[model samples]
Target: MAIVKLSTTERRRLSVFFTCLGLAIVAWIFTTLSSPLPFIINEALVYKNSPQKKAFHPLQADTIKITIQGTGWQMLFSKMKPDSKPITVDLTPLESRNYVVLSSQLKLINAKRDANQQITAIDPDTLYFDFTNRLTKKVPVRALLGIDYQKQFAISGNVSIKPAYVTVSGPADRLQKIDEWKTDSIKASNVNESIATRINLQPVTEGNLTIYPKSVQVNIPVDEFTEKTLDIPVKLINNHNYDNVKVFPQKVKVTFTTSLSRYKDMSDDLFEATADLDLWRDHGYSTLPVQLTRFPPFCKIVKVSPANIDFIIKK
Candidate 1:
């Protein structure tokens, strides 16, 4: 094809038209992508892969105000949120604080965001971590448990926790006074059956503290109790005038309850029933209260038949 050259005025007019067309395209793009939209993501910052020798503290809790831009449809339907996991911020880049800029970690933060969304600005643009030497300590674990059984039910044995101690590693000063860590509240109500469950260790507010065993298994022994009766002789003591007074009944029935495991261990020999003569009256016959001086361990005294014994005064 042969080229036909136009005059300078015609060419100028054509160049102007092309320039206007180019400006129109650029204006369309600027309107579509340049206007910043504010999207505030709250409580979404996470730290990972920090230096093993150094510990970081007071992780930033401020909201991430990401001023982003996208096509109208992209901004309308697709939510633009940032995840900080992929962001690798070297806190000890130069073994000094000056290396990382104080004003903005956005470049480090931007690496974590979705690629399609364009970020124009971020608010509170600076975050600096306070670093300290990592610390490790072995602390004991205490359980926090409460139980209320149904009527006539009780615990058979002590509550037991597996792995009574845990390793807590964090900043030295923070872990220095923490001799023990307690588990979260494990409350069971109206519980007649035995309890066996895994309990989580209560976390401390200290930053960068790691627990070796985050949880432990707790076992509680429970069983329905049984009661038994035994005739125990009442021993009289501390009587000023024993020859002048007499107790009518020589023995009383003592009823007690114990766990099945300890049922066979209880006997009248393990208990001592007694009556005091201090409250005696000069009347022919009077009632005196019977008191237990001793009883078997872990056995509950339910009843003492004939709580009051009749005594006839001879003098």
Candidate 2:
């Protein structure tokens, strides 16, 4: 069985060295299958049966897009993570704009990829979303507190909110633009005493908003004051003929600070002291500027003492 031909220039140089080794193995298999290797499955595309009652707007928690076909050295050793069984978009039977992953469900992310690595694709491959209709309302819980009383004490009555109101739900045009529901600042400094706790409901998220009692129970009623002088007796506002205009110390010595439970119901007739004869100051010793016009609510004036008095203009 001898057949060593080896002629005609050695068989045309062995057919040009086997056609240049078959064009270098067809250019290394066409650069390893068209060199496709784009990975970015940060995670999130595994939604299964979402939509728990008409509030669908949050379902892409990982920015997915895994394309693989290796050759970049077998995708750097096939360590391409991201495939814990995701890519499942159920949405409770989808009804509006369906197809959130229909290419045969991408074989459940190509069976967790890695062996032969052929995810080939999976970038939005088909997606759509939009949902609403799930509203409830009760609102009436405003208490963004941040009081810092102590210099003379303040804040008495009507700042409480133990069930004052709450029952928010979202999407009815955003709960009709919400009526009320504030409480997340809640701060207190030096406060003399009294300020209960529990307060957090100012998130208001957005789309699928909700707040049913997220947190509310603030009773700020601090009371620890006691500075009251009250010399009272100085009335005469807009005096144009108040019997002939006359005011030179009619009486003005009110110093405020009530909070000891209304400091004995605060005397001096709740306070009025007025004397603004249009702020008379004709510069004829007509001095006139002590005005109180009623004051009393956590009281804390402190000084007024003839803050400007003595008038007698009578053109």
Candidate 3:
């Protein structure tokens, strides 16, 4: 094929023509997007004024389709961001009726929204709810803790929660199923000192349920621990025959760790060590094993001298 060549002036004119065409296309797009028009978008709904005497569950999804009138640019952006803040819907009307008309709330809803993008209409126009018997109950709050104490440090007393129980109000059936509410996990390492802080309760996922005072104050008493030794007399148990039986060792030294604050309060009276004669009689064992029948709950037993004891039985 023969090649066709153009002069320098002709080439320049061609380039200018295409550039103008591109500019016109760009201007057309901007003008179209700047026009005001109606567009549809979905928005989440937030409820207020929930009835105290009745528990309600929405009959439909918690979202509504809204027709908004705004410039094309606003519509485009709204479409891109479907997760904008939810529109607050008043549920006061539910107290007298089972449904609420969205049209009536348009004025209030629009008052808080930007003027550039106004909501024109709501799909489904009305909201409906299912009602159930409301029940209020108090449930204990349980704390979840993950703590690592430093050397010779430990919890000195019971962990205290300011409000031991939380008030929950919801559908009777739902509330009945809930026995207790728990706080979020409290985690720490090298926890040498007492802890005092506010912790949030696990949120109620069911929209119809409500919990009062979403958070509670926690107090954990921590203290340094030291070793304590006590000579506790070993008592004989299950000596049914009342035979004269004497254990070689009458007392054993018990070494345990207790909180420094309670060190002075520790004594042999708080512990009970016993030798079970039943062990020797039932199994014909040569020696009786000594065991601690009772001890302080907070103390950690470290060493018990002479775990097994020799006994003499006079026939």
Worst 10 residues of 3 by lDDT: 76-85
Residues 1-315, candidate 1: write the lDDT tens digits: 999999999999999999999999989876865465544332334444445666666546534555555555455444553343322344444245523432355665656567756466654455556667888888778889788898767887777888878988778778887899999988999988889999999965443567779899888888778998999999876676655657768899999888777788777899999987766634433688899999876678889989999876675
The C-alpha stretches of model 3 lying farther than 4 A from their native spots are 1-46, 58-89, 99-128
The digit string of per-residue lDDT tens for model 3 on 14-75 reads 99999999999999999999998898888888888889899988898888899888888887
Estimate every model's Cα lDDT from 0 to 1.
0.71, 0.70, 0.90
**Full ranking by lDDT:** 3, 1, 2
Sort the predicted structures by TM-score, highest score first. 3, 1, 2
Q: Which residue pairs collide in model 2, if any?
A: 43-62
Give per-model TM-scores: 0.52, 0.30, 0.69
How accurate locally is residue 291 in candidate 1, as Cα lDDT from 0 to 100?
A: 96
Give the clashing residue pairs of candidate 1, or none.
none
> Hey, what RMSD does candidate 2 come out at?
20.5
Candidate 2 on 1-315: residue-level lDDT in tens? 997978999899999999999999999877875586554433345455544366546544345666666566554544553335444445545655433654656675566555666566766666665576776889798887677887767777678788899987766876788888888998778888887888777865443565676887788887777787878889887656555777788888988877677777778888988876665534434576787878876577989897888766555
Colliding residue pairs in candidate 3: none
